[model samples]
Target: MYLSDKVLIVEGKTDKRRIEEVLVEPVQIICTFGTMGVSKLDEILEQLDGSEIYILSDADKEGRKIRKWFKKHLSESTHIYIDPKFGEVGRCPRDYLANLLMRHGFYVDTSLIMKGKFYDERAVGDTGYIQSYSL
Candidate 1:
């Protein structure tokens, strides 16, 4: 998780927060905020110098365009391909992201020890607790 030399370029804040949640150590994360503006060019390039770059874009058309840009700019970098079938980057599960990060040599544990916001047996049949998944 802690990659001082490597940095992750994400699409939005939610994706950043999701990755941060599962990471065991601090890794530099950059959210492009839909599109990369001119001002961000220098900042991104700074990280690119002597550092490995990983792009984590959404599954949408806009995301693809950005991916193309990164590929054109930094072809040597690796990209974390998010399956469109699962939805966009923000909707991806923490475990999946963690697994993907692991492939890039990041130390992340996807198995969350804390129940967190997940529905428990007690929450079943409760009107307020909308069941999002089945065990």
Candidate 2:
């Protein structure tokens, strides 16, 4: 299988699908399925060798647990957060997701960014605290 140099670790298939929709560039997104077994992690680690990794987990208890796990196993991975109000990546608006990925240096579908401009602001509730990711 082909793997892009950029890898984004998410919580589940839904999260993967959500990200795939807005990403314009190639990024190998892998799902942890809400948790990971040691063997699964080892296999993922082997596949991720020398790749630039990013973790975009949900902002909740289970997601926090997954983030902690990645922190232990993949210390070099960058972390991306969705506002707590959204709680999960799959529920986050497409425009918001596009902009967030773009700010992290990932190329996103410009149409999605423009579409986000027309999205109802109350949905995301003034999310000015977007964290920056540096390469």
Candidate 3:
């Protein structure tokens, strides 16, 4: 669920799919494919469209390398990281990841907790992952 309004630069397809699955709306995710080549970066820049870019990468060595590259090239972007205490994004629990996202005001795409409404209200505290109440 890549948002057309903003661009999310991630490490790979798995991260893209996972983020998309939990998002309430589509997001624009750019996959590095594993350390994107300098030659390919021009294309990504073209697609950026002046929107805010968010960098969410794994905590491992390669992830850091990729982050560094993006920071150097795309200096004016926000970098989001999962708390290492939980785990890497790929293996992290979905709800946990959702909470991490929610901390930043992003909400999950929800279904049928009520007849017409989607999410009810703001979830309380740091762990604000969505909760379903069957109607």
Candidate 4:
């Protein structure tokens, strides 16, 4: 199973959205939010059908617990942790998962889509350029 053909399993909708936003290629994203149990794990694994898998979750204690449980169940899947830096407001997870994957040699960056916003407050502070004032 190749990484490109694999599916990424996340913890919630926000994680799914963020992963989609950062990934260079289109891959399936699965969410397992609020459904943490043995049955749910079995169901998800069955749906995966032994395909290559990557697990990206928060870098907190809860995330660690989830990872442990997933590892115990889906021992064959490839799991990776997305650092907390990718999270939004320290609550909603961000798209840093994709970036971390790219850092590894498994995934490739195709379209090079750059999501998120960039602010340039310096433009507003350029008094000389705006007011035509010379030093």
Candidate 5:
């Protein structure tokens, strides 16, 4: 129910903002800005008091790279990846992300769009959010 101890780590401001908009609990979000600098990430991780960490990045190659990076450095932290299946319908990380949360039983607002709305012709374009990442 309450995600007071669970933190969602993303890759940028837009991802963080979009995720916060849909979550019911107070989920702390951290952005790595393409590649998370070791010192910066270390500082952020140090501040965390053993909270569960969920990594939600774009369902693309770059996202996998970032996830891999985190896995190597934060192996002890509980980590879960946003499902890539949702990305097939809508490339916006938010769409797949919202669905991922829904699958995990997290309450997310779907009033503006219903289930499977991602398959709508209007929602077919890619967000290009993953292109900016180098990995």
Candidate 6:
């Protein structure tokens, strides 16, 4: 596959699949499977140089571990957090992911931007979408 300037690091295939549904631009998404290890890091490092990296994992213990590992090795990478309520990236509402990605300057499918029942209406600002539940 062609390499993309932007790379998204996710926890598993399910998470990768969810993000793929809304992506409008080319982004290489890599799955960590679960907890990160030296071997996995070695594989991921090859594609990281000169690319914009975005770390997005679940809101759970294993996810935090992976995030911490990435932070230590890839401090320059941007971290994208999903609200604890969503639990897992794969489980997060599509609209929520769409808005979050948009705020991060990533192109997403506009059709996935409709309001979700869990969104706080008050948070909708000039962007015309939920600001973000992510940190």
Pick by lDDT: which candidate is best? Answer: 6
> Residue 93 of model 3: what lDDT?
60
Off by over 4 Å in 3: 1-3, 85-87, 110-135
**What's model 4's lDDT at 101?**
56
Query: What TM-score would every model get versus the actual structure?
Result: 0.74, 0.80, 0.74, 0.64, 0.64, 0.83
Better of 1 and 3 by lDDT: 1
Judging by TM-score, tell me the better candidate of 1 and 4.
Answer: 1
lDDT of 1: 0.71
What C-alpha lDDT values do all the predictions have? 0.71, 0.79, 0.69, 0.57, 0.61, 0.83
Q: Backbone collision count in every prediction?
A: 1, 0, 9, 1, 0, 0
**Model 5 bad stretches (over 4 Å):** 1-3, 78-96, 110-113, 117-135
* Model 4 superposed RMSD (Cα): 11.8
> Given candidate 3, what's the lDDT at residue 104?
55
Model 2: C-alpha RMSD to truth? 6.9
Where is the poorest 10-residue window by lDDT in model 5? 126-135
Candidate 4 clashes between residue pairs 3 or more apart in a chain or in different chains: 86-94
Model 4 alpha-carbon drift over 4 Å, by segment: 1-4, 85-97, 105-135
| Model 5 lDDT per residue over 1-135, tens place | 444777777778877777776665566877776676678778778857787777777677767787787789887654556457644212355655555565544445554334464423333238621111111
RMSD of model 1 against the true structure: 10.1
- On TM-score, the candidate that comes out on top is 6
Per-residue lDDT tens digits for candidate 1, residues 65-118, read 878888887788889887787667778777666656665666565354224433
**Candidate 3 per-residue lDDT over residues 34-117, each given as its tens digit:** 686787678788988888888888888878887888889989988889767544566656666665565555555443222222
Instruction: Report the candidate with higher lDDT, 2 versus 5.
Output: 2
Q: Which ten-residue region of model 2 has the weakest summed lDDT?
A: 126-135
lDDT of 5 at 108: 53
Clashes of 1: 1
